[model samples]
Target: MTATRRAAILIGVFFLLTEIGAIAARLLYAPVLTIPGYVLGSGRDPLVYTGVLFEVLLVIAVVGTAVAAYPVLARHNRAVALAYVTARILEAAIITLGTLSLLTVLMLRQQPHAEPGALETVADALLALQDGTLLFGPGLALGIGSILLASLMYTSRLVPRGIAVLGLAGGAVITLSTVAVIFGLYGQFSAIGLVVALPVFVWEISLALWLIFKGFNTAALERMPRRSVDAAGAEVAS
Candidate 1:
């Protein structure tokens, strides 16, 4: 296999692994958190630790996927590749913030003997930060990044336009939902956001599977840009 093709395959595998890890972590999280609360009166520490570990793993998986995919993207289109990298970095930052926010919330919840005024205010602020991070940060980054990456992939002939369209729609939903949350429209619209996000997650997982199992047709990859150049040259000569 060509180096580029090999890189693409590896990147595809990483993407698949990341998604699988995320799904697994999500599945395990509630059960683990509840166990501490149900069994022991003070499962708070265990739950928080588990949550932190899960978030750390999630961050690693995301970063690893981005690094693995970098070569393929760099080969196809530099601008798009940079954008992809930037988006992933932004995503990492969002996740980090989210993790920290959650940790803060956990700390506040686990406080043993409460203070009077200042500590209470600090805890309230932390809680607000947690809410803000959860409500907006990751979703915005993920949605915008997905749309940008999908557009690049479609334009570069790396994927189907339909996928790009779906990604674009998902980005729109995410952005709108975030706005709604900021504006205090969190009742019915938040549910709609969840509904919209489910298909997007499915689409991404399917795309990752296709990329890993089938790989891209290298022949098509080679022909696309060359044909574009040849056509352009012909126009110039005419």
Candidate 2:
């Protein structure tokens, strides 16, 4: 297979990994996120550790999607492509921070505490940090990055226009919904949140499957190596 074809497959695989890792990590983190005083409770440590593993993998996958897709995107619009990568990095950094907070929660349980209820207080604060990161990382950064990448795809005609449209709508919806959540319109993961986020989820899955099976509209990218795309009013010989 050609290098571009292989890159498309790699991007698809990373997208699928991001999906699986996200779901697995969230479910595995239930005890810490939901149960009361999980830092004080015993058992289920293994599950939490497994969740950490999933999240670590998720962070890798999150960045992989942007990196794998960057070359082709840069050919079309270097500035937007760079912006997408930045957004993905921001998302991954926020997720790492959230994961670290959870790890700190677990660590707090092991260490001895002098003040009464201090463990619970600190654990609760860490848990809150985790949630806040989720709101900004997956909710905000993901949305912005999706829009940037999808807009490149849409304007460049590198993929089916219909798929690109879905991505555009999905990104806008999720970003707006996240803003509402930020204003206390609803809880993150509430019914409203799920409804607003569904378009983006579907968009990602569709894009992943398309890349894996059909690949990009290679006709448009036949000269991809030259970085001579005429989209977005940008042109370059680099």
**Candidate number achieving the greatest lDDT relative to the actual structure:** 2
TM-score of each model, in listed order: 0.74, 0.93
Q: Top TM-score: which candidate number? A: 2
After superposition, candidate 1 runs with Cα above 4 Å error = 17-44, 107-124, 187-189, 223-238
Write one digit per residue (lDDT tens) for candidate 2, span 53-163: 999999999999999999878887788999999999999999999999999888777765434388889899999899999889988999999899889989888889999
Q: Which ranges of candidate 2 are over 4 A from the true structure?
A: 113-116, 223-225, 228-238
What's the lDDT for candidate 1?
0.62
Worst 10-residue lDDT window, candidate 1: 32-41
Query: In order, what lDDT does every prediction score?
Result: 0.62, 0.89
The TM-score that candidate 1 achieves is: 0.74
Location of the lowest summed lDDT over 10 successive residues in candidate 2:
222-231
- Per-model clash counts, in order, read 0, 0
